[model samples]
Target: MGKSLYSQIGSLQNDLNATVGSTENTQPSSKVNRVTRDAEVTKQQILDAAVIEFAKNGLFGARTDAIAKSAGVAPRMIYYYFQSKEGLYQAVLEQPASEFQQMLEQMNLEELPAIEALQVFLRTVIAYEISHRYQGMLLFQEANQNQGKYFQQTNWSQPLTYVTKILEKGMQEGTFCKQDPYMTTLTIAGICVFYANAYENLKHLTPDVELLSDEMIERYTQAAINLVLNGVLA
Candidate 1:
């Protein structure tokens, strides 16, 4: 028979405790690395659970106890790593922004044609918004209720600047008509967010449709990319 859930959890706890109790000075380097890795894994678990809680309830409404319960960690662990609920919320926002920056760096947009770069950027945003639906909703809530205070606290400028550079490149190449880069970036971002923000309403209006199915996502993504590109293309 498969292990019971409680038994599995108990086994994991035992393993974690053993790793933590291992003496750093006496243990081999491999054991020390295991301890560090285990700690990171535990911290990540708490963050993942906190994301769901914050997305559903917003920062003001979410509770640390609930996050701990959801993460399957002791409540003290949250305080130990994140310091406070607000700290964890900040980390959540920062993590995605950091990932976005890394992705832009890896894309090497300078090598691609202006139009191709724009398409790749749009597709990436749309796919990320679709996969991380709750993140979009949480951002929306933060903007409305918190006056975007948390957003201002993170390093979001790099990604915004990256998009603006793409737009500027297109204009310089004479492939896209001259326009305000900031406004153009906003327009493209809005276009990508539209379907995701309106998903529930769309589902209500068309009760038979699976709006999130792969086919529908592809259709919407392609349509949005084509529309944005056509508007900007000279």
Candidate 2:
């Protein structure tokens, strides 16, 4: 029999820590760096596979075996990394928010005018939804089937707060109509994700459309931004 999954993961973690500890003490060797990189790659591979599985099947329908097979790892590896399927599902749900936070952090949103800021936010979110098409589908599935139990556990406050501040700034600056920031945020997010959520049906309905193509995505993004900004602009 091969090595147990628990032992395999523990060993990899130990090796990773040892490599990092050595690097802290002295200049890192090429071999140590390579090992560290490989470990990180392996972990990411597992996450990539889990994302696809969970997105396609949702939590209740997803299987650890399928994820492991897709990742080219042993079945127990999933448990070793995530503890359980539910844990992996939670990670999938949290990924978009984490990525969204990182993307927003890189932008100089505070300095932009409120109207421009809102437009930027809308474009960014719509682009993200298009690029990560599975994420929107997964979110829709969770909302309808699981009633957003896993989604609630994720920390979305950062992006939500960011959008709320933009709306408030717009209202204060007299660039946008006064509205409930939270509700407005919901509406904006709905607009950004609606196409992605309905992609399958839309594709079936319009076989020639290629809705996810770059040109179409650009058209959709621009149209959404225009529609939203027009509705709220003072």
Candidate 3:
């Protein structure tokens, strides 16, 4: 109801639009191109369509036929590629997390001190959430609909544990103040995720302003950084 919240929502809407591929003007590929590459392309198409449908309509309300139609593929292709609608949803969320894991593997965690590590980690988390808006939408939906129980059972659980481990290591090395690692991780996640979901509210709260522009995203990212690092760093 506040302008600040409304501004955040406007930003989120823009991010969501970018994430769902709605902003792209993709033409249908030739049916003659039904090679292995074509199959993978079609599979991505179906998943992209599914993200739009599922984000707007929830799981039970999302129709496979509509997803197939939007994707320019047969309805059966959705099932053939993903096994089920829910399977496709899980894939959408898991794919980005897998990428995050790869990025983490390439990083030298021990080299960065606690404050810098937290800053970099939080930046990555926020950037990923902004870029992969559909994944955030799906994760939010799962959290509300299943109360986070479903996520707890999936590969989604790995990131939280990873963050906790980093926090513990920082504490052991006297780089961060003593505190509950899990709680700190939850706090960081909440600040990024709650703003995303409540973007509509943020938009209303901050009247007469554009919140999704490049400059505004930079501001939001910095504000998030200030909040988390200030309290955790020794």
Model 2 TM-score (2 dp): 0.83
Assess candidate 3 and give its TM-score to the true structure.
Answer: 0.77
> Against the true structure, candidate 1 has what lDDT?
0.79
Candidate number with greatest TM-score = 1
The alpha-carbon root-mean-square deviation between model 1 and the true structure, to one decimal in Å, is 8.7
The C-alpha stretches of model 3 lying farther than 4 A from their native spots are 1-34
lDDT of 1 by residue, 1-234 (tens): 012322333443344334344345655876877878789879888988988888888889989999999999999999999999999999987766776676667668779999989887777767666666677777876787688899899987788788899999999999999999999888887898888877867899878889887677778888998899888999
Instruction: Determine which window of 10 residues in candidate 1 has minimal summed lDDT.
Output: 1-10
At residue 76, what lDDT does model 3 achieve? 89
lDDT of 2 by residue, 1-28 (tens): 0123223334433443342323344456
Candidate 3 C-alpha error for residue 233, in Å:
1.5
Residue pairs with clashing backbones, model 1: none
* Collision count of model 3: 20
Ranking by TM-score: 1, 2, 3
Clashes of 2: 0
lDDT of each: 0.79, 0.77, 0.69
